[model samples]
Target: MIMLSDWHPDIIEFIISKMQNPRILRYLLENTEDEQIKKAAQDKLKFTPLTAQEQDMYQGIINYKQIPGLGGFSDKIIKEAEEKLRTGGTYSVHNSEFLTGANISVCLTSDFMEAVENDEEYSLRFPDVEKYDEEEMKFYNENWHEIGDVREWEQMGYKVRTYRKMRAKELWNLINVCATYSAEPGIFFIDNANDMTNAKAYGQKVVATNPCGE
Candidate 1:
């Protein structure tokens, strides 16, 4: 027997995850001649997060370890991660509850934060880099040989390098390479047919329900 009753958790999961919630039944009932297409799930707009509440929710989500049973790491890292995210934007990973948890699988090359301080010989590295002003010099000092902030240049008609993990159609390496640096992203991919996830709301954060949704 196929159990067909619509459930609340499933509905909530569907709303946030954007994977399983079916609007087809509603569409059929509303537009087609199917009287038998009764509402499979009750209206879930009520369960949605309010703007202020969502802000607060994102706040706690960025620090998932705060949940009583979800112990993971220090709040400092959570804070740092959030602060960094403020500049970096989402790094995919929108599969659970938060869009950009604390990791990533892919990111634009320019997503790296400008180096505020770095030590490297300028002559052998970039002789032309010396012409820039103090702040630019400091940035060069901080990120020599490192990919130029091609992220911004990407918009200004310059070529940009992107990274990938799986051998799909893309450029650069997958985001895991960031572990080599100290700024890796944690991701949670989602798809309608195969998207059943159980995040404890534990750890320092959970994945985003829908990254682009935000």
Candidate 2:
């Protein structure tokens, strides 16, 4: 048996790369602070090809949900998409290209559709402003709205930045851009979806669908 001291970093990393047991790999991923060892364990866990049996086991499983709606878009999100587009050296009229590249399917709600029809403004709230540390406060102060008249939020024991609103024309423009450029971001009436769902009686609301629309 090899002593613990006999196992050098290179030997441990080689062993980790060859390790087939997922539990040991996961334990090393979580418990180890050595960055190289952690990366080796993570790479082994993440990049290893699944066997035919493993693929068959997860064939029909809906493991991920993509929930994108009106409230999901923000300045930070937009900037990230812009940076990604720039770095990728791709030019597109719509940001939905990023979502498509990321394999994210959007399901717009009834409220979003109604807002488009009625020309209602879209509002975004920055929550938990009171909990921000110095660095966070500085970043938000530079990038987001200034804190003002937070009496209502403060009364509720939560301080927040002044809410921002986008005009109805902007929302319509987004839809038109998506339609023209990407032909994506599918719409689903959430109320109708929940009404048809069997889990409503269990006090569970259907918020989003998996990639397979199940």
Candidate 3:
């Protein structure tokens, strides 16, 4: 098999043009002085078609009600947990245990201490739940714009929502659940993770960690 290092410059350019990773495309667009490469990146970013694998992953995330393996908690899950805490109901650890029992450890992050200490609104943007059909996907691709925040999406006529502010009491209750019951949902300092990540230079943020915190 031909090695990737042996690929021609034209072949590599073609591969980069087909890439779906917006971060890499955006980096090339902004950092490269080559007009042709910049145009290619811009075109790619304007209409990123989801690959079969990406479509399946999105479906799995929706179906499982959680991201499989070690990852940051999606805003939907976080909102659910917040609701449970607010209602004096304990959040369920059965899911975490189920994954752990299957040899798949789950870890999640929250700015609990930061929220409590700063008395900040522990708000999170709700995740997109719509399953797009081919036509819908085409429409989305045609209108796709890089949204820096949920508010920008909303401004672009996309439906968006945010979770209510989480208080110290609710966060403490979550901590209590972790302390007394399952230790599967280990606390991850996401802010620190992103701050220290070298990926930041490439316009990427660290969002998850492996089971062993790698």
Number of the top candidate by lDDT? 2
Per-residue lDDT of model 3, residues 106-208, tens digit only: 1223444555667554444432426556765565566543333343455666654443443443334333333334332344455567678899999986545
Candidate 2 Cα outliers beyond 4 Å, as residue runs: 1-101, 129-162
Task: Compose the digit string of candidate 2's lDDT tens values, residues 116-201.
Answer: 68877644344455888887666557744332212333554555543445544444443343334433333344557777899979
Residue pairs with clashing backbones, model 2: none
Task: Report lDDT per candidate.
Answer: 0.30, 0.44, 0.44
The true-structure Cα RMSD of candidate 2 reads 24.4
Clashing pairs in 3: none
- In model 1, the runs with Cα more than 4 Å from the true position are 1-172, 192-194, 197-214
For model 1, how big is the CA root-mean-square deviation? 25.4
Candidate 3 C-alpha error for residue 13, in Å: 45
Candidate 3 regions with alpha-carbon error over 4 angstroms: 1-97, 102-112, 118-121, 128-159, 163-165
Residues forming the 10-long window of minimal summed lDDT in candidate 2: 1-10
Clashes of each: 20, 0, 0
For model 3, how big is the CA root-mean-square deviation?
A: 23.5
